[model samples]
Target chain A: MALTLMKGSEAIAEAAIRAGCRYFFGYPITPQTEIPEYMSERMPEIGGCFLQAESEVGAINMVYGAAGTGERVLTSSSSPGVSLKQEGISYIAGAKLPCVIMNVMRGGPGLGSIQAGQADYFQATKGGGHGDYHLVVFAPASVQEAIDIMSVAFDTADKYQCPVMIVADGMICQMMEPVELPEMKEYKVDLEKKPWAANGHGFSKKSGRSIINSMYINTEDLTVHNQNLQAIYREIEANEVRFEAYNMENAEIIVTAFGTVARIAKSAIDDLKEEGINVGLFRPITLWPFPYKELHDAAVAPGVKAVLDVELNAGQMLEDVKLAVNGDTKVDLLSRLGSQMPTPEEIKEKLLSMREVL
Target chain B: MKEVIVLIGNYGSGKTELALNFAFRAARQGKKVELLDLDMVNTYFRLTDRANLVKSHEIRLVSPNFVHSSVETLSLPAEVASAFALDWDTVIFDVGGDPAGATALGRYKEDFDALPEGSLTVLNVVNTRRPMAGTPAKLVRLMRDMGRPSRQAVSGFINNTNLARLARPEDLRYGYEVIREASIASGVPVLYTTGRPDLLETFLSEGHDPAFIGEPMAIETFMHRDWETFTKEGL
Candidate 1:
């Protein structure tokens, strides 16, 4: 496919459509509003449903209802909106339903600024809602990666029968970059084929009724369900941990970042390389099943001095990096709080300053 | 030769993309280019987002002070006033999308009026796919709406009909016919039509008029959402 420039949020919506996601429910939010806007225009033409719900809470519940029918469903929102959908997301996860949710994060603790920030790292990776559930989180650095990740997000969701979250920042949601879109997949919505789907199959001798509910009244049943959820999370952590290491071998300082911040860190690494400073970059593609083993291996590699966690928020992902390094090396943070972004030069200067400690 | 070009269009008419491409094209042709990003409406996908890229191509970019800044204010920077006084071979104003967006251009009405009579050209960009300019009458109405507020006459129209990477020769033809009708109704000439470089040959082979086509300018869709592609691999 030829490369065409696209905004990250719009591309993700188009990719979901190509992946045969026929049901979309979302509300308007800055930075990520284009996703719903694009879906509203394209969904009806493709024989799919696009609905602008009254609120993020309503939108996520709609997704929950749609995914219960075994249909590929998608919902997108920004940080505050994502918070509103937490109850629905937790319910969807508890029901063991498959759906794709996108959180194009903005600066937030409350109703924060409408700019890029990685403060949601802990919220996304460490269950946002009250539960022992873990969502498979994918963080894309570029528009192309956003497309590719979204193309498979539905499949990943269906394979595990769990909700998958594509965690991106406002920068990725707003920036335009060249991307090659994926081919449209053939999707058929046949309720009869999915026996587990709650598509009005009445309780009879031949057909068994399927119930979709998150309320496990029995304590023992809920405990076992929690155990099963943990097993799934363990499997995801074991098999689906993805990360990209750039110039990690023979590195003095290893910088860790994810999503758009990782791309900026890569640029900083390149500039430092030109100046004869050996700085490597470790980008976690899957935020929730984070590349812990890989990051630890890289941090413990010979001649590795310190690991810097560059982020748009003040030290949210630094804890994860420190956990991965496990005292083998000092894991510090260089961040811009409240939606501010660190430029390549600023990151390079921080990396240079860490040389004395190394 | 036109020294000043002002682009006005409905929302999603590809006006900003066209303005950016035109600035780079003029610079590549050895003309000193100055691009004024007069888009104060939409925060994202503005010319200021590509300021460094435009600067790299030697095109001077004049944008609001808060562009790409954390301030998020809509106040225009003082540099925009100096843009009119600066001497450059080509000065392009990338007006914001929609009639309301064109109101920002009113601040520089006197500077634009003081230019040589034929040197300043206001081009209304049209795409048939956009709701505001889907028909000839709607296109004309959009032109008048934008022209009145900006205090600039719409001298010509640029047919930028496209569906991102899915643009077919037939799509361009459909857009051209709509633009043709719009031109006759509004009495404004069709300056040129833009499309992918690869599709231009197909447009000509399909018997599109060379007169209305003008020189085949290779216009790329730089402002697109992420899942939109230009390749025919799947189709």
Candidate 2:
């Protein structure tokens, strides 16, 4: 075990590798490119599989192939590249395949820029791929959190038979921060326990018949399958919502954001507090199944006049805040689009503007 | 005024194919079009390859040749800017897949300030199977991710129908309407439709900003028709 400085994206890759991820497939795209590049060099050294796929499409499908065999699998790409892999991601979700997907977000609509951004919030949390499915979406704002979440993501995926995404932005991917590596536990997955995997079913009668994650049988059966998925999602929502709250006591404004935007929000909140402005922060650690109840309570607190939603993209997460607050509190948006990130000073100015309205 | 077209879209939505087609059409129209390969993501097919096709029509092909084809950063060479200062009829920047590539545009954004405001069109390809393909809310978010409020930036999107092969006109029409409505809602504009080559006549005749080509039409047609259907319905 060793403590070292690592970029958020690199930490996730290294952590997953140490956690017994034997296969890695990805197409290089910005923000998240270092993960695959790192794995490309590191995986071979550890006697693992590292493939630079023909395209993002090919990379996710390759992940499906590996995951179907009950292997530890991972893929990383940026927003545009992740968009290309949606079909495969949806298929993986439908199949209940356990794998890791990392999206280092950048600004967009089309060809936006390579700078750090949190614009992919909705896409990552609301099932970016498709179908009535959910992924364990972990938003890691710091490099250490990024590494910690990788193990959590893999475990969550395995526990629930689902895919997981370590959703970070370009800042987390590119910035270097100190990390204390946890004691590495080398793992050898017992595919024998996963009878549903594509591994040959002839090993033991107790292993049962192999299974696939498709819902293509009869319409009613498909409906039943969908209902089952809904139930699973409900279970996840009930049990897995997570977040971090800082200095809410007697606070006037609760600034909400996730990923890199959250870190900026934190800095803004701190700076405002120093200036005698009571601004608090509620940062969601798990984006999907958003920490709505915490946000609701935060909004309803006395003297909490307004909530400012900050993001790299304009007003995408603001809608969710609206839904969460249900009009009990006013929601204001201070946002930047494409590759531009709102600095702490900018966010502080926004909070100051909320003074009159709140 | 220099018209700058920034080709953009989800992969498999045919942004590249449309860029190629636009290059051909713009060059054919006797406009001094410079095809700039700004796509740093996908390594394979790039606008750089069609330099001859554009050169034949006197369309200047401008791109920095990297030692490695796989490198994804598109740095606007100084020469390209020098040419831009000189009166090029149009400049097409085949920007990479998403905002990451768009960030690269920040370096050359000053160059764009020199062009007429409305002439800079950011082409959004509507592909259904891709993320945010069928949802307007998601599309709006995608726009936000690209940068907000698109008013000063993205003027319009090009609805390129799955690389333009096996694409029904209905898909093209749907993509047009959805993106058009999105643009209107966001105060941007839907410039034109990118679909099958045959449909090019329809758009050309209709004067829909000149038809743009879509994807790997032959292979993606049958399998990725969901994109076509989504684009059609969205429009």
Candidate 3:
């Protein structure tokens, strides 16, 4: 396929279609609104379904209903809207259904500005909804990575029978860049093939009927279900940790960041390297199953002096980096709150100042 | 050469980016260029945000005074009038997207009309990928909407068919065909089909004349998307 320029939101929508996601339910919100807009136009043309739910809550519930039938479904919204969908998300998680949700984050506590921010790191990685379950969260730094992650997010969701979240900021949502789309995939749903799907096969002769529900009135039964969900999360943590290490072989400083901030950190690292300052970058692509071991290793690398965490918010992800680094080294933060993004020069200066103190 | 080129279109149709590309193109050819940032509808992705890059190319940037300030105002700055008074070889107005945005142009309708006939060209920049202007009828409606507010007739169309960096040759052809239909309906000519240099090559190989396609614009994706943050090297 030839390279084409695409906005982050539209690219993700198209990639989901190519990945065989035939059902989409979403409400409009800034930054991420393009996804729903794109799907609304493209889905009908592809013989698929696109519905603009009344609200975020309504949208997530629609996703839950669709996923119960073993269909590839998706929904997207920004921070505040994502919050509204939490109750439904919790229900979907409890039901052990599979679906993809995207939260193109914006600054917030309440009705935050429509600009990129990493403030939702805790909500996403720590599980926003009331739950004892975890979401496989993929934080992509580029549109291409967003496309690639979205393509597999559905498969991963179905594999674990859980919801997967793609965490991006408004910057990623609105920006346009060249991307080579993946080949279109053909996925046919065979109702009879999946005994667990609610495909209207009543409990009678050949196949057993499926009941999709999260309610377990009995305390003991609920405990068992929670335990099983924990086991799945543990397995995910052990196997799905993904992080990219740059110039880590011999570095005096290790910089930890993710998504858009990570790329800015990389440019800073490049400049620092030119100035003979040994700095490295560790970007965690999966936020939930954070690359704890990899980050710890990088933090304690030979001759490493300190660890710095950069973000678009005031030190939300910094806590995660601190937990990963333990007491192995000193941890610091460089951040710009709200919609502000730090430039490479700003990051480079911060790193240099940290080096002086070290 | 047109003394003034006015770019108007629906929101998110890549009008600001196209204006920047056109300004740089004229400056590279050693033409004295002045860029007017009349976009007040969108606070982000405006030409004023890239003042340093524009000045680096030796192009004078005229922007609304309220731009980049905490206060958002729709009033055109006095500098815009000063820009019109200048004797620059080429002056490009990066109008706000949409008809509401084009209302800013009404303030300068008199000055625009004073220019000799054919010296001013209003090009409706169309990105077929955008939902609002995807079809010829919708595009004709958009042109009409913008034209009514600017009080100037659209002389031609610029086919900016793209899916961002993922655009292919077929996308351009698809957009060109729609624009062709739109041109007939609106009685406007299709002045140029613009896109990234690489994708434009595919259009040419398919027998599109360079003159018809216009010079391929090397647009820098400065409006940072999430992908640009991590992938430093590639466009």
Question: DockQ: which candidate is best?
Answer: 3
lDDT values, one for every candidate = 0.82, 0.71, 0.83
lDDT per residue for candidate 3 within A83-123, as digits (tens), equals 99999989999999989999999878788777887888888
Which of 1 and 3 is the better model by TM-score? Answer: 3
- List, for all models, the DockQ compared with the true complex: 0.16, 0.01, 0.29
Candidate 2 structure quality by residue, lDDT tens digits, A1-358 = 4234354666778888877788999998776777886797578867899999999999999999889888789999998898899999999988878998988887786666766667777788787776888887888877778887778888778877888887887767755444566666676667645656776644564445667667667889889888877888898899888899898999888888887678767877777788888888988898888888889999999989888888888788788888899999988888787666677778888888779765
Q: How high is the lDDT of residue A326 in model 3?
A: 89
In candidate 1, position A230 carries an lDDT of: 84
Off by over 4 Å in 1: A189-194, A201-207, B1-6, B10-14, B17-41, B45-95, B98-122, B126-156, B159-189, B193-208, B215-235
lDDT of 2 at B200: 46
State model 2's lDDT: 0.71
DockQ score for model 3, please? 0.29
Give iRMSD, candidate 2. 20.7
Which sequence of candidate numbers ranks them by lDDT, best first? 3, 1, 2
lDDT of 3 by residue, B102-217 (tens): 99998788998888878998888888876567789889887887878899998788888877655677888888778878877777887877877777777767875443455455
The model with the greater lDDT, 1 or 2, is 1
TM-score on alpha carbons, each prediction: 0.76, 0.61, 0.79
For model 1, state the Cα shift of residue A257 in Å. Answer: 0.6
